[model samples]
Target: MAGLYTDQLKLGLDDVGWVFAIEQSGSIVGALLGFWLTPRVSWRPLIVGAAFLAAVANAFTANVDGFAALAALRFASGLGMMVATLVSACLLARSPNPDRAFGAGLTLNCLLNAVFVWLMAKLLAESGYAAAILSAAGLFGLILVLGLALSGDLRGDFEAPPATPESGAVRLAAARTGLAGLVLFGLAINMIWVFLERVGLSNGLQAGDLGNAFALGLLAGTAGSAIPFVVGDSGNRARMIAITTAGLVAGIALAWWATDYWTFVAAVAILASVWNMGLAYYMAMTAENDPTGRYTRAIYIAVVAAQAAGPAIAASLLEFSHIGTVFAISPLPAIFALLLVAAVAGAPRVEGSSLAR
Candidate 1:
């Protein structure tokens, strides 16, 4: 949408929201679809296809002259990327260990996106939006080749666990219990994510400096997650989650209030590390209870839906709040999520679950 905003396409309000929806439609749809399936039905091919198509579609955007054409391309891009995301999620679920699975996934995603963004910035600097798109096309083409080689119709290795169909009453009760807490968690996390970059810019940080903040934060978080993978059991996962959420609350507040680069970076790193650790722990919990594969898919649906909606929900709150106020407000949701982690801990674990499964 930003690209279209600066292009001959001359996009406006729709571009900001609707166009984004269109462009990421594939990821949105594919993730939901992926959650509905089991490990044996891996969506890798769909994801692979999506990546290749996204590049092709992006490359062709240069030829588009008006809003309508741009919209079409954006919609196509959405379709492609969503499939890729869905594939990734399916893979995540199939991991024998959720925390380890998530740690690896986070690392891979961060590294790839970091490289991709660096290339994009370089391309944009040298040749503008069109060149950036072309550069992405080349990257996507490379992804397609690798995907084709490693995943020749072998994407569906995971299988859904058997369903012991519960009554509607039992299921609705479960959902009612979970809905509020999940929304709160999403809002809290996204609030931190969306505004962190802006905070850096507001503090007189140079262009692209925020990337370093994310890199450091994620690395710290990964290191923390590694500790649990080496020693902890599911019994103490809730405490870890609570501690991490508290850290996120404190980190966000400090980042909003702090002035120096060291202070801000320190806050960012703490926020990144603990928040991701919380996520890994929480995801592990979800996987534990999802032995039938059906429940696991549903959990993924909640997570993916949250991922799609969190930023928009956070942005809406920013309309009436100052930066400090907004940053402070996010803790409410983090607190709520911490409570959920505690409550969900009381739920039973289903055996033989995979993060990618």
Candidate 2:
């Protein structure tokens, strides 16, 4: 959203980067907090409180006068949202079919994002910045209600028995690899996503066309997420990740060469879909490999940290290089992530554990 309305926010390029950084920094902090506290406390109250915090923070953000104030509010909002997000991940990680669970979650998120983006674009056209901000706040307020209705502990049904020392070591090793891969994957995706609008504009697309393309791409991401849910346990998560990574690389390449609107749209849709699908599988892999929820909780921390770094790094690169150069560099992290996934796939499974469904 900040990417789409930099002018309205009175932000320069550096300011935009800082805005994303501050918000994601807050998310990293919140994820760490959730990691520490989730096992010690009731998640219901925490989620309820966080939802209220997000609602109030975003509501106040709509009226903030300056960049600093807005940034601070966004930080608070990020913290709240991250707490909620991590808790939800913890719940989903315990499901029997974690791949499908993660895919369903991703599908819902992408669908909502697509809807909200389209709505925000329309509202901004009619009502300006305050309304758009308020609309977001309203959504957060609704989340607060949903949070209130949620019952029981955030921990899910399946709690793996305490691991043996050797098994614990193995799980930790695999989890670390998965988390590292996720961080790299996130960096690759966001590097392109953060600059997509600018890329489109540079290619002579109008603002409306770009927004529409983004909305469509998000919808395609929704479809991508749904695929795993439809197929259930396909028993080929590593293969899926590999294929999606290749598709993402191709999407980036197409985006670099695309001069026409339709070509750019196709590129964005493919990128968005494959990125979401790949991350869903990656998340499922982490959850399944480490059922204790220890490493799974930390995944959000890595993700937010990478999201904070990717654009900042890309922004720096843009100072001395062409956008195409940055796009070319973007796929390297994803390729490395795929390699890590392969390693995880080939690792020996724990006794009585199933890698293939």
Candidate 3:
């Protein structure tokens, strides 16, 4: 949603990062609280409550005129969304086939996000920013209702016994590496994603055209997610990450240089697809490595923190450097993430099994 209306939200690029940062601050806080409380508290009421909070925040978001007021409301909405998101992540981590589960979840999410993007784009065109925000609030309200229907007594599975002290230490180390990798990944992706619509507009594309491109890109993302579900756990996860990372890099480069409409569309689609595919694998790897889901919980924190930092970093960079420089530098974090993932993949096995699943 931020992507859809970021240009219309304000006139300049100078302070745009603050909007994302403030929202992410709330996300990080909510994720931390959700991670701490999820194990001890029942999920049903927590999810319902969080969804309600987000709905209210989003509902009032359009009324604010100042960046400070908008940021505060976005913060509140982030809190609600992050709580529900973390709960869902924890649930997915507990699945018997975490890879497939995560993949399927990503596929579904991407498809839904695409649909919402189209709807929001139309709402923004027809009504205004207020309607777009209100639509998001309405969606959250629907999510609240769905949470109620899906609510039940849920618990994590204990398939394997708790790790020994040494094993726990090893897992913790690996998990930290994975978390760092994820932070870098988030930074790379969000830096481009938050600015993509603006990039298109600057490149001579219409708002409607950009919206359509985004919708198509999201559909491609759905396919990317589906690939992991189709391949399941038997495929080489590390190799998959490397391939998707390469694709993402190429896509970013194309977007940087794209002069034609079709070129931009293709670049956007590839970028969206590879980003979704890469993260699905990353999340699955995190869940697989940490049986207790603590590492998985940390994934959201790293992601939110990176999201807060990425756009701010990009915005600051724009003060001195060209947008092309921003795009060129974007892939550096992803490359570092790839290397970290490779290192985790190569770490010595414990109990005759690789530390990373």
Candidate 4:
């Protein structure tokens, strides 16, 4: 949508960052509020209310013109989306098998995302941006309905018996490490992902072709996220993150080198697949670090902040240097992220066990 928004509003590529940054600002605020309130309130109302808010905001988004109005609407939408998202994350974090739970959730999400991207492409082509935005609003409306139907009553869900002092200190340290890693991981992925359509267009691909590529790529992402669900908690989480990160780096490199459409499609597939796979492992690791879901709320904050920063940073790089430079530096954050998390929770340590020394 960033690409399309640029064309619709006649914005430069760097302006895309401003849009994402403004939206993410609302997410950061919502995440902070969720972090503070989850321990005090019920998740059901929060989710339902947030969904309604987002639905309304997105519905009105089609009627707005100019960057400021669009940003304001998107910011409202982001705020609602983030609050709902963090509540869901907290619930998943408290699950019996957090790894498999998060995996299943992401698998379903990516599957839906594939269809959403395709639909957005078609809607924008046939009906213009308003229809696409209205469709998003409609989707949020559906989420509001689902929240009413599916969300259980879970007050005091964040309450947990305190760990012993010795163990508590260790878990806190490890959770902080993993959260930092998550920040980097989120930054790296979104930086490239937000610009992916532009990358393809620069290489002579049509919007429809890129749309098809994204759809196929996100289907691969569904499979990638599902691997953890299939493997369950028995699989090595840190090792999985490392492998997926390596694949992501390779895909980024390949995307930079790709000249042909098929080659670009292959790169998109790999990039989408591995980053989503990596996300499951990252979230699972953070959840494993803290069962109480307190830190998990912080995960939303860290991720939202990074998601905001990634585009701004990438946009800056694009402004100051070549796209090649953006590609060159992009993988470094992911590499650093892997190193940070693996240092604390490397292989040979099973899930829910104390972080490896």
Clash pairs, candidate 2, are: none
The window of 10 residues in a row where model 3 has the poorest summed lDDT is 154-163
lDDT of 1 by residue, 1-357 (tens): 255344555556656667666655655665565655435554556556778878888888756677667777777776666566556645565676666776666656556765777787787788877777777678778767666665545454434455444433233333333344445666677666777778877877765666676666665555555544553445366676667777777788777775566676787777766655655565555554444445444544555567667776667767876767777777787687666555545555434322111
Task: Indicate the TM-score of model 3.
Answer: 0.84
The sequence of per-residue lDDT tens digits that candidate 2 reaches over residues 1-357 is 775446776788999878877887778889988888787777788787888888888778767778888789889988999998888777777778888998888888887877788788788889988788777878777777887777765543336767677666666666677678788988998888888888888888889888777766667667778877776567587788787889889898887777787888788888878877776777777877776677787878888888878988899999999988889899999899888777766878775444422
Q: Give the per-residue lDDT digits (tens) of candidate 3, residues 1-357.
A: 776446556635656767776787898899899878777777778888899999999888767666777788899999999998888888788776777888888888887777787798789889988898788899889889988876578643324446676666666666666667778888998888777777788888888877677766667667788888888777887788788889989888777776667788898888877877777777877777776667787778877788778988998999999877788899899899888877877877666233444
Evaluated against the true structure, the overall lDDT of model 1 is 0.61
RMSD of 2: 2.9
Error of 3 at 51 (Å): 1.0
* Model 1 misplacement above 4 A: 1-14, 24-26, 36-44, 126-129, 149-183, 197-235, 298-300, 307-325, 346-357
Q: In terms of TM-score, which candidate is stronger, 1 or 4?
A: 4
Looking at candidate 4, what is the lDDT of residue 184? 88
Worst 10 residues of 2 by lDDT: 348-357
Q: Model 4 RMSD to the real structure?
A: 3.5
All candidates: TM-score: 0.74, 0.88, 0.84, 0.84
